[model samples]
Target: MNQAVQYKLKMALTINWFCYIGLLVLFAVWNLFLEGGSIPLWCIQTLPLLLVLPGLMQQRYRSYLWLCFILLLYITTGIVDVMMPTRGWQDGAMLVLSLILFFSAMMSSRWHRLQ
Candidate 1:
């Protein structure tokens, strides 16, 4: 295995949580203008795994399962939110998540390749 790959795999956990925290902030943004205040399943499900993908990819078993649980809820929550996000901030939040997800995934994959 390349040292690069090892290094990248190491960072997966951090990236995952960074994304999740970003999502939480996004939710807070939604709170400002939305009338309904229930979180969707997609947000709940995907939020977690996205948080842990870094460690999971590296085979960090301790929190992999926990991440999966979060991912599950995020996925469901995201779907529901998509259908009906009362808060104005939801859309922006999704856009940000999309960008973050794209960048993180790309960078990590490249890092793995370099290793």
Candidate 2:
């Protein structure tokens, strides 16, 4: 990959990592406190993010590649949540963030492969 593309990929990956984590934290907080969601259920819901977090922090290309596939669950959740009347905005945010994360991971993986 070109140096410029590599740099952009790095930035995108970083942003995706942060955004993904942030979205999870935000969701947890919103559900736990605001919506009175169950604690155990919340943990279960966030488990996928936790599972992939180490790889994300390590900046592994293979991890990013896999994460692209794993993130589909989140995308589907976002789509379902977006259909609700009350939390549509938050879900829309998740949908957008998931898309960003997906695109960034895809590009990052491709760029790393090129390297």
Residue-by-residue lDDT tens digits, candidate 1, 24-111: 6666555534565445744653455456657755745544445444444445555566667463456546655645554555555545
lDDT of 2: 0.79
> Which 10 consecutive residues of model 1 have the lowest summed lDDT?
62-71
TM-score of 1: 0.47
Clashing pairs in 2: none
Q: What local lDDT does model 1 show for residue 104?
A: 55
Model 1 alpha-carbon drift over 4 Å, by segment: 32-60, 84-115
**Candidate 2 lDDT tens digits, 1-115:** 5889878877986888777887787678757976657788778777877777788788788888788887898899888888877674567877888888898888888777777
In model 2, the number of clashes is 0
Models 1 onward score TM values of 0.47, 0.84
Candidate 1: C-alpha RMSD to true structure equals 6.3
